[model samples]
Target: MSTLTKQDTFQSLLDSASSSFAPIRTQAKETYLTQGLPALKEEEYKFTSIAKKLESKIQEFKSALPFAVSKEDIESVLFEGFDGDVLVFSNGKYLPELSTSPEGITVSSLSQAENTPLGSIAKPEKDAFSALNLASFSDGLFISVPKKQKVEKPILLISFNQANSGQVIQPRVWIEAGDFSEVTFIDHSISQTEDPYFVNKVVEIKGGLNSHVNYYRLQNESKNAIEVSNIHTDIFQDSRFTSVNLSLSGDMVRNNLTLNLLGSNSEGNMYGVYLLNGKTHVDNHTNVDHTIPHAESNELYKGILADQSRGVFNGKIFVRQDAQKTNAFQQNNNILLSEDAIVNTKPQLEIWADDVKCSHGCTVGQLDEEALFYLKARGIDKNTATGLLLYAFAGEVLEKIEEESFRSYAISLIQERLGSKF
Candidate 1:
C-alpha cells in the first residue's frame, strides 16, 4: 500500500466534495497539483514558502460549522467610534442582521448576486485558492456604488472567526465602483476563539473609468490562526486604486495583491505594514501590471520583526511592450528588532517598454544604535525609545493614508503592537 501525502489527502477531500461544485473543485485540484508549492526558485515566490507551511498546517481543508457568532456579538466588533456601512460575517457566513447600509449603496450576499447582472464579477478563476473559494464559499459581500455618485461613508466588511472546534473558514467579497463613482472599502479579520483554524479569503475589486477606490485590510487574527488572502483589482482609464495592508497577528500569513492597469492614465498604489512577534510569520506578495500607455504604479512595504518572528515581502512591477511612458516604483524595507528575527525583502521590476520609467529597491536592517542612544541619553528608557523609533519608521508609510480617521485608527493599532501608547 502507498502512503498518501498531505496534498493527496486534500485532493481526496476535494474530490469527495465535488458534487457541490464539481468543475471548480476539479480545476482547483489540478492547479494545486500542477503548481505544486511555489518555491524559492519561482521568481514571484522567491521570498516566501507558502506551499511548505500550507502542507504542514492544513491536513485537509474541512468545512463544518463548529460554532456561530450572533449578530449582537458581531456588532461590538465594529470600529467603535467610526461611521460606515458595516457588513459582518461570522465563520464565513454573512450575518445580514448585523449589517447596515444607507440608501444609494447596494449590499447583498454573493449567492444572491449570482442570480443578477452583478454575477459577472463573481466568475471563477484558475487560481487554486480562488477556485476553492468559489466552489465552497458559504457567504460573502457584494457592494456596488452607483455611477456618478460619491459614497459619503466608508464601507466596512468585518470577518469574524469564532469557531472553537478548529474548523476552516472561507470568506469572499466582490466590490464594483461605477464610472465617476468614489468609495472606500475596509476589510477587517478577527478571531474570537483561541483554537487554531484557517482563514481563506478572496476579494475582487473593479474600478470603472474615472472612478476612485481606496481599499484597506486589517488582519489581526489570533496567534494560533493561519490566514491566506488574495486581492485582485482592475483599474480603468483615469481611475485610481489604492490598497493598504496591515498585518499584526497570525501564526502564518500569506497575502497576494494583484493590480491591473487596463487603461491609460490609471494609477495604482500598494502599501503594507507587517509587525510580527514571537514565532509569527508573515509574507506579502504583490504585482502591478501596467498594460497600457502612461499608466503609473507605486508600491511600498515595510515590516518589523521581533523575537523569533519572520517577515517576507515580494513586490513585482511589469510594464508591457505597449505601456509606453509608464512610471512604476517599488520599495521594501524591514527592521529586525531582535537578533533572532529574520526578514526577506525582494523588489523586482520587469519592463518590456523602453520608454517606461521603472525602479525597484529593497533594504533589511536593524534599529539605529546611534539614534537609540541619543534618545536614551535624554532620560528615555530603552524600551520606550525603541518603540518611538519604530513608530517613526512606520510613520513614513502611515502618512500615505489620506483619510484622517482611518489613519488615526491604524496609528493607534500600530502603537499598541509596539507596546507604546503613542
Candidate 2:
C-alpha cells in the first residue's frame, strides 16, 4: 500500500466523517494546506513548537471508539454543590442525555444548531482549528441565552476524556448571549484516562448589546496529556465580558484567547493562573482588539513553575484608528521555583488611535531572596516560605475570581499543586 499524503489523509478523514458541515471541512483543509501548519519561524509561534508536535502525532489518527462514557461518568466530574444547567461531552461526542438547560436557554448539539437560524454564526473563518472543529466535530455544545433574560445559575459545560487507551479528542462549544441578558458559564476539561491523550478544544462566545457574560475555564488533564484551547469572544455596545482561565495539568498546554470589542463603551477582563510541575509546559496567548471608541480591557496572568517546568505568556492589546479613548492594560508575571524552571513572557500594545491609553508589561523572576530569608528567620522552612511567596505572587489573579466557591476551590487546588501548607 502507498503511504498517504497529508492532503489525502485530511480529505479521507473529512470524507469518512458524517459531518453536517461539508463546506467548512473543505475550507479548513484548504487553509491548512495553504498555511501549512504554523512553523516555529512564524512570529506568533516563535517560542512554541506546536506545529512540530502535531506533525509528529498526525499518524496516530485511527478509527476506533476507545470507550463509551455515560451520564453517570459526568456526575462524577461535577464540582460538588454546583447546581445549574449541564452539558457533557465525552471524547468529543456530546451526550444529550447528560445535558440539561434552563428555560429561555437553548442547548443542543453543534450539528443541529448548524441547521437552525443561527447556522450563519458557524461561518468558516481563517482560523484553521475553528474550521476543523466545524467540519469534523461529531458532538459539541451550543448555548443560546435568550434576550433580556438573566440566568440565575451558572451554566456548566464539561468535556471529559475517559478513554482507556491513548487517543485524540476535539471538543467545540459555541455560546450566544442575547441583548440585555446576563449569564455565567464554566467550561471544564477533565481526563479520566491514564494513557496519553490529546485534546483540541475551541469555544466561541458572542455578546449582544448591554449584555453581560462571565466565563470560567478549568483544564485539569493528565500529566501525559496535550491540550490546545482557543477561545474567541465578541462584545457589542456597552457589553461586559469576563474570562478566567485556570491551567493545572497536561504535559503541554496552550491557551489562545481573543476578544473583539466591536462596539463602544464595552469592557473586557481576562485573568489566568497556571501552576506547573515536572516537565509541564503551558503557554497563554491573548489578544484584545478595540474597534470602537471608549472601550476598556484589562488582563492579568500569573504562573508558578517548579521542577524544571516551563511557562510562556504573550499578550497583545490592539487599538484601531477609530477606537478613540480606548483604555487597555495587560500584565504577566511568573515565579520560577527552581533554577531549571523557565518563563518566557512578552506583553505588547499597538495603538493606532492617538487618544487611546494602553500599557503592557511582563516580569519573569524568582522568589525574592530577601523575603525568603525573612520568612526563614521567622522559623519557616524553605519549602513553606517558597510556597507562601508563590501563593502571594498568584493571589492577585486568584482573588479576582468573584465566585466564592470557585475562588476557594482554585486556591486549594493551587496549594495542593504546590504541595506545601502555609
Q: Residues 1-422, candidate 1, lDDT per residue (tens digit)?
A: 01223355345435444354345545655545554445556665565555566556655556645356676676666665677777777787777876776569778886667543321333344344565565555556777888998998887777778754335687777788999999988878878877767777888889999999999888888998877787888899999999989899988898989999999999999998998999999989888889999999988899999999999887889889999999999999899988999998777888899997888998899989999999999999998898899999888888877666678888988987786674
Query: What TM-score does each of the candidates earn?
Result: 0.90, 0.92
- lDDT against the true structure, each candidate: 0.78, 0.77
- lDDT per residue (tens digit) for residues 251-334 in model 2: 778888999999999999999999888988899989898999999999999998889888999998999999999999999988
Off by over 4 Å in 2: 1-12, 63-66, 70-72, 114-125, 164-166
In candidate 1, position 309 carries an lDDT of: 96
Model 2 Cα RMSD, Å? 3.0
Using alpha carbons, what is the TM-score of model 1?
Answer: 0.90
What are the runs in model 1 whose C-alpha is more than 4 Å off? 1-8, 11-47, 115-126, 164-166
Positional deviation of residue 381's Cα in model 1 after best superposition, in angstroms: 2.0
- Measured with C-alpha atoms, the lDDT of residue 100 in candidate 2 is 78
